[model samples]
Target: MILAEELTKILSSDQVTQNLTILQQHSQDESFHEPHLPDVVVFPKSSNDVSRILSFANEHRIPVVPFGAGSGLEGHAIPVQGGITLDFALMNRILEIYPSDFCVKVQPGVTRLQLNKELKKYGLFFSVDPGADATLGGMAATNASGTTAVRYGIMRDQVRDLEVVLADGRTIHTGGQAVKSSSGYHLNGLFTGSEGTLGVFTELTLKVYGIPECVMAARAAFPTVKQALNTATSILTAGIPIAKMELVDSRSILQMNRFQETDYPVMPTLFLEFHGNDNGLEQETAFTRLIAEEQACVDFIYESDSKERKKLWKARHHLSYAFRHGSPGKHIEGTDVCVPLSCLADSIEHARKKMEEADIDGAVIGHIGDGNYHTLLVIDPDDPNDRKKAHEINKAIVEFALQHGGTCTGEHGVGLGKIRYQRTEHGNALDVMMDLKRLLDPNHILNPGKLFPMSSPSTLNIN
Candidate 1:
């Protein structure tokens, strides 16, 4: 098409394409949201390439969506307006490594596994693992957190700086290498989870951690969800430095057993981990065990062997896919909500009741240590009734979270999936956010049809 030809002139013929296969690939992500094809896809290898492309698209009023690994469950990378899709696949490069400062600089296309693999040689690691081997750019855009977040923190906390190309094609850096500064607005936090609506990330400077001296993984099963959640809260309340704490309901465990071929008991389970020196870990584990026993935990299995620990976490990481695998022809619509710790059990119980009332099929799994949980709703994609019921359950759960000082999404950013909750969750603050969007992207060319407009935008105003 004409757009591809023009972008080719700006970059190279090889970097720009209207190939039907490539367009189809960029149309959707792992989300249940319907996909839309972009008019063209452009591959950029450097910040200058991204800057020039943004400039050309901005002048002509074109929607530009940044594409990453396409692993997002919220359609964060889908190019709904069909303009120019910026694929950063060629920009995968680890630019610098400062082991002394426990930091690393990397291109947007670099995956979490890729960075962690390299950091292994230096005895350091990047912690914000959202599973799925997702690109670091996508993780930052979503502000992803995973099992380890209870200890190390989320993606926003780890990002030291970001090099961004704005809507007008101007290049700017959000922050520097300094550990802390009071110099300016905290732009680093602003852009990190902007969901590609504000700008495109070209490079990221992130903090890393030294691998723990002693690491252990354990599984504790409880008779009920409440007991498991109570055990997790108790461990946290007692000041145990648990590295990773996850909740997998009995139904989810059934799916995990079928998928991973394990003989774990079908019960509400808390997958736990501890990090510290040998002596400290021993004392912490003992205390945690005592707390679990008090909560009537039926089984407490611990492992220090590296391979066994990997297998344990592997099952947790792939639990979502397991749900999909178990259901023959159903699509999974995962709901993410984070309530206050005091309200987590109540929120989850509410979700369970709503799903029962709607007669929907799904399982509950989450990073319960931080009061975040997800209900994986399975529905027949071809059945409108089924889809409606699943969404209804989702709405009830999100409303419960919002009513109790919680967010609609804890890790997944406001993509097309969570736009309806923006007004209620942010109140008047959402208007200020929209003003910022207008100020930064006056033409609305940067990722239009996302994080605004309550519903999908049929026609975006480019004037």
Candidate 2:
């Protein structure tokens, strides 16, 4: 019997599949990276199922790639070796809720929107929103952060514990129910962003937050990118405690206007939010308005009503799709680089100039509050020149980020796309990382050809 038949012996027949359509769906993520099909797909209903699947694959030397919602932007979900793809859809369940402790335990497949909808009853919500309704498991894998990261922190901060199934099928819990610990190893931090190369996360205990008593959203348009950046930095310098600070350039605003059918000013803009009690928010917005005005803010619009506030954020979240709608017959090559606040303006300006020099149609958008930004480049996949220009621009941006004290990838994990820069970004630490990977997965049956670039197509030799 083949791998699918063997897996059926371990799992229910309905849980094991080699269907062409399912394989095609599991082949890639939401990225421009080339797709490759998995040989078989298996859905695990419990930790025991995951353990059995890993034990079998490890012994037989078959590659196993853990897959969640496949919403990743960096090709992290592709099963390059064509072995088994472990789909977590069947394992999605919010196992526990401790409202007083501000923690929730969940299976790996639960999506952000699904969890938030359920959390609404207790006036609690998970804060690490990566815009997409991405599975919490996938977000944990990528260490995802979004607009609210400046206030609530990244997925790494939200994780309290992880129940991981090792390559040899040994089950381990990286952490526990306690809020803080001076424990050994800090395994939770290590495994949270391992990108499936270390082990498979079967269960996650994440930190949640109570809904803020008062919230407000504002939009400030600036005459130039520098002015907008200056205003944002000023707010942070002054310690205004803003919940979310997002930057959208003129080109992005134009696209958002056309796609969302809203009349936002066609200029560089900052989407700002404040979360606190009414008295505190009143003071914060007042001080923030003062800073924006001093920096030559062209227009400042406030949305106090909850409905209008939600609508404002909705437009910002759908920006990637808006770019797609604005540019047909083209794919978006999103560049993720983050720099220190002091260098953010220069980095962004450099990215914009590179795009202009290449004559590429794209937009600059980001979570400016925390200095993570994206240069969305629209390129015709069929045109070699377009692809080359996009790659060159991305390289320039990454080089600039690395030259400064910034990361090649801020929120997006180093999958197939960012592996080339791993050496430059992490240096000797990359060697240490590879050593750990080999130590945990001696046979390299975990996700291969990712995070660490392959020396050859058929082997996992990193040196």
Candidate 1 — what's its lDDT?
A: 0.89
Model 1: residues >4 Å from true position, as ranges? 454-463
What TM-score would every model get versus the actual structure? Answer: 0.97, 0.97
Residue lDDT tens for model 1, 1-463? 3777678788988998888999999999988999999988899989999999999888788889999999998888888878889999999999999999999999999999999999999999999878679999989998999888999999999999999999998989999888888988999999988999889999999999999999999999999889999999889889899999999888888889999999899999999999998999988998899999999998998888999999998888888788888888888888798989999888888888898899887888889989989999889999999988988898889999999999999987779999999999999999999999888888888888888872222333321
How many residue pairs clash (N, CA or C atoms closer than 3 angstroms) in each of the candidate models, in the order given?
Answer: 0, 0
Query: What TM value does model 2 have?
Result: 0.97
Range of the 10 consecutive residues with the lowest summed lDDT in candidate 1? 454-463
**What pairs collide in candidate 1?**
none
Candidate that would win on lDDT: 2
Predicted candidate 2 versus true structure: per-residue lDDT over 1-463, tens digit per residue: 3778788899999998888999999999988889999888999999999999999888787888999999899999999888889999998999999999999999999999999999989999999888788899989999999889988999999999999999999999999889999979899999998899889999999999999999999999999988999999899899887889999999899999999999999999999999889988888898999999999998998877899999998888888789888888889888699999888888988999999999998988879988899988999999999999999999999999999999998999898889999999999999999899889988888898899964312332111
lDDT of 2: 0.90
